[model samples]
Target: MTATTAPAPSRLQRVAALAGAETRLLLRNRTAVVNSLLLPLFLVAFVPVAGLGGDGPLGPRLVVTAFAVTLVFLTYHNLVTTYVARREELVLQRMRSGELTPGEVLLGTAVPTLLVTLAQVVLVLAGTAVIGEWSAPTDVVLPLVALLGGMLLMTLLAAASTSFTRTAESAQITTLPLVVLASITSGIVVPLTAFPEQVAQVVRLTPIEPVVELARLGLAGQTWDGRSVDWAAAPQPLLVLAAWIAVAAAVAPRVFRWAPRR
Candidate 1:
């Protein structure tokens, strides 16, 4: 007789399976579904409520939608809820003991939400192309990277938050700080430009500010106002975003909980 061990699943296979299961779970949870979709939709709807910006909205609209979409689906609402839910249910602890590595566990969680976000980003871009005064980003690379970085940072922060979250129900309150900050100071709810120069500079220091700036810079001058975007202003924001990501990365492994807090 010979003993045999099963081969580990490839990262792609593991992630895909986890994502499929997670998607179904997300669909079943009415609360998660609404928070993921409706909350972001509310922000999208509020774009008009904010009134036309200095530009009719092509500019402000693009930035707001991009930031809000990422914030809602990627981090604040979706990931936090899922993390706490999984932890409370012992789903995360079970995954840890299985073939799914820790990285696979987290990646699997983010991918489904990432797919949802990808769809929204494309839809908004298409809308801009059709009705917007300017169609494309001034520099695609910076904005694309920044938005991606925002997703990664937000995802990391969501996992780190689970350290303090005792249950799925408490996630609603736990996620509020990031949600409120992004809504107020991160340039999603109101463009930093509307703030005074002093205030704008201070606001830019917020966690999500660089994320919004990336979208703003990328979408530059595509607004109804037809303002000109300065592409030269990419480095500082890149550094700011990178720094926040570094901090989150440092905090994540330390703060991440494998068992429910008693």
Candidate 2:
């Protein structure tokens, strides 16, 4: 008997195939696209152009907060609804028939989201540069750590959030805790400077604050607004973000659901 063998797809090909399908689905899901991309961009574009903060090009801190919020919208908020919807529809369960592992499925799902987040970051940087004389990052490593950490933490949290979320519609309510906290307390919509000193001190410990602060610190020591901040204060926030990431990672896998609760 003649041997017949077909070429097997590589690992990257498999993930790419999954991502292609996911991208198509995301495109059709206009609601998800609007929530993740269009709205976040609107806020970022609105801040400085709307003159919300006066004639200045907006402070580095404010810029940082805006970008951090975009990341959360794209990575965390988007994934929560997507995962829940897929699980409820049994799409995730159906994928089990493939030659892929659970980890591969999740990783594949994230590729498009990650690419979109990277583009958002580039837009944030370019937008800041156009608005002001943005400086090169003071500490390259820390900013990278902050972005990567924030993404990882949010990923785990998204998966974990699905455990509590029962339907695609309810995701709006379940995700409100994080979205509200970031917008109100974590300096996304409002800056720390707006808060009273004592309140700001406590708010610094909030989940998204460190990532936002780290983003600010990544900019030059002296910003276009002639604002000078202490780079030496980086350690504390770094520790806070790292601690949260650890907690989320450890808890996510244990709590994440692969199927609908009912």
Candidate 3:
């Protein structure tokens, strides 16, 4: 009998392989690319043209919020749904048997989506700067914090949502609630500042609120308050996001299926 041997790749190598494959697959899907990238650009362009008027601080805020929504819904949420579907189809199960670990799988899957979001943010910022005459950010750290937090939150939210999704096709319908809520109340279509004080207060408690506020403040070269950068003002949103992340991380490992529901 001949002896058989195999080489195990390092963790980093496995992650890189998975990430590269996922990124290529994502790019090949024309519809997904368009929905993830072009749709948001269209909204960014159309909203202002439809009398939203990019003339002041609110204009840049709206643009950034819209861009962020697109990043969350089209890329983050969609990727989660797709990942769950793939897992249920036994794709993830087989991959797990290879060099990739669960953590590697999740992180690798998110890398491409995060890159797409970054590109979208750049496009939106450029468009707003040109059309709305918006200034570049003053305190870039604030918005970077928001973006990082938002990406992490969205990934966790996706994992949580996948637990409820029985099939790949069902993911489309299942993710609608978050999509709608984030679109309206997250300051995408309208500024939270425009809402009544009580309503704004309530909205500010949501996960997306702080992100939008931070992005707006960052773009305007302003701090949380007129005094200085108060990271405390962002606590509620960050807490909400962190709670969601904890829930998803805890629940997904328990409930996520590696084979088809049937």
Query: Which predicted model would earn the best lDDT?
Result: 2
lDDT of 3 by residue, 68-87 (tens): 66556766677767788678
Q: Which stretches of candidate 3 lie over 4 Å from their true place?
A: 1-8, 50-55, 129-132, 193-196, 221-240
Per-candidate Cα lDDT values, in order, are: 0.71, 0.72, 0.68
Candidates by TM-score, descending order: 1, 2, 3
- Model 2 Cα lDDT, one tens digit per residue, 1-262: 9999988887788889999989887779787666555654565667665544212335554456555766676788878888898889988888866787776677778777877776666666666677674666676776777788788778878888989999989998999898888777665456666778788878888878788767666654532123555567678888989888888888887887888887
Q: Model 2 scores what on Cα lDDT? A: 0.72
Report the number of backbone clashes for model 1.
Answer: 0
**Model 2 stretches astray by more than 4 angstroms:** 1-11, 30-37, 49-62, 130-134, 193-199, 220-231
Q: Please report the candidate that would top TM-score against the real structure.
A: 1
Query: Candidate 1: where is the Cα deviation over 4 Å?
Result: 1-7, 29-45, 52-60, 72-74, 130-134, 193-196, 221-227
Best-to-worst ranking by lDDT: 2, 1, 3
